[model samples]
Target: MPEDNHSTVTEFILTGFPGLHPEYQGLVSAVLFLVYVLTLTGNVTIVFLFATNRSLHKPMYYIILNLSICDILFSTTTLPKIISKYWFQSETISFTACFVQMYFVHYLGTVNSFILLLMAFDRYVAICHPLRYPIVLKKSTIQILSITAWVIAKTGPLMLVIRAYPLPYCASNIINHCYCDHIGITVLACTDRAPYGFPALVLAMFILLGSLAFIMFSYCSIIIAVLKIANVQGRIKTLSTCSTQLIIISLYYLPRCFVYLASNVGITFSPDLRIVIIMLYSLFPPMINPIIYCLRAKDMRESLWKQFNRRIFTQKAQVPSVSN
Candidate 1:
């Protein structure tokens, strides 16, 4: 296709949610809107709690703050547009907007994976080398690592989008998901061979395989160190921390690995399965992260409750004073 021909394609259609009957658009919208709201509120609350609470200033909480931010970005990037598409049947996205959305989706997704890997490393250092944990995860070191992860996550995807979007999109440009996913967008390309396709594949491999491998290695070391503790109570306490980190890491990463690898392998999922996977990929992590951290970590749980009570009392106090 010529450049002029490609320029003629102004916007792309998103297939909305697959398997949702047109008649049920209202119901689907209601349900999805509720989910979107919950996701936003939950993740935002965690971010606020992490930021305002001075007690949450440690390395682990710092990473939790990053995770919360990533969750908010991830959900915002995909869900609201999906809800609109399903409800209003407005499926058009401009080429430029689609590229921007794709870049953020990939960036946030990769960042989420990298943050989880960092969390695993944090837990390992805490458990395996308790005395050195503070020194190792100092504010300066944490800042540098966080910046590095963001850079690593954004670099490849941004480059890929720059290369991919300029190619011809003369054929059908309807993406089949809520947002502009790489696989869905690739299916819409007029060219069979994508210039950015190989780079995307490499990035995915680095994130999915490389990150997961590093996390697993960290956990293995953590488990070994925990086992060697002579005191049973100490061993249990150490294992509990590692176990919570492991569970959240699995919930966040495994689905991602499955989806990315499946996409790479050309495995086609049904629309319902795709939606479910996307929900799991986007919503579940944000919803579960704070819950896991609060429940498993005593300090976080107390701080959260204290923060909640403090807000409630402050509001009550202000109301009485205003009324008086």
Candidate 2:
């Protein structure tokens, strides 16, 4: 607990993909950069599409917008630094910067999880309690809940960083990852046991298991309601709306739960495998989210096409006017 009882380790050396052949660095960098670009573009497009379309002003689209924003921040938190590390062979991150990175990464990730849960709740209410859905999920209520989620998600990491400040950083400050991950940072801690460990575990439970349970419960109820519907069209309509959400939730949660549980259980894998899983966790959801929403939500697709055709027609009309 003594603040001065530790070694003064200034920066952590990141051993990303250690012992990999140097020739593959460029290839890895290129692949990571491409994934980062796609993540950014896809999430930004979703945010823009939601923001511009007045028809998407409901609670569901609001949650989608928040989710997209969280995705943008989440990807930015880890991938850019990872790409830079591979591309430039720069692996050193200052303690302050590392903590900041970890904070935002957890914050955005937790917020994203909660937002998805809220989306599930929204869908559940719409499906199960159609009459009260609008009143239950008013604009003010959505805003309040969204802000609360962000605040709660951010609080744990921030406090953990503060608590861990007292722990000494000895000479061994090598982080075996491309970015500042919680486990990587903890591995570098010189103390016998990090003070942040328990809090981090609690946060992980809340973010992953708690959210997962909520989502599953909501979906279970949704499934039962859909089954009870007598009309085929009604059942199909409800099922279709929930299907994309189910797919996205599975993709986002399953890998995360696996990785997190594995790390906690001391089942250490190779750093390269770790990197691959982390990259998969970071990149895939963002890339797939827009695709799922656009493809599954008929209204979103129509809106996108409407906007696209409007632009094309505007350009064509402008050409004729210019010629005249």
Pick the TM-score winner: 2
Query: lDDT of each structure?
Result: 0.80, 0.81
- Candidate 2, clashing residue pairs? none
Expressed as tens digits, the lDDT of each residue in 120-236 for candidate 1 is 889888888889998999977887898889887878788878777777777787787778878778767777655557767787788778889999999889878877989999988
Q: Worst ten-residue run, lDDT, model 2? A: 1-10
TM-score per candidate, chains pooled:
0.90, 0.92
Q: After superposition, how far is residue 83 of candidate 2 from its true place, in Å?
A: 1.2
The local distance difference test score of model 2 is 0.81
**Cα miss at 220, model 2 (Å)?**
1.0
lDDT, candidate 2, at 55: 89
Tens-digit lDDT string for candidate 2 (6-58) = 55887887777777688998998898788878878877878777878888887
Each candidate: RMSD: 2.8, 2.3
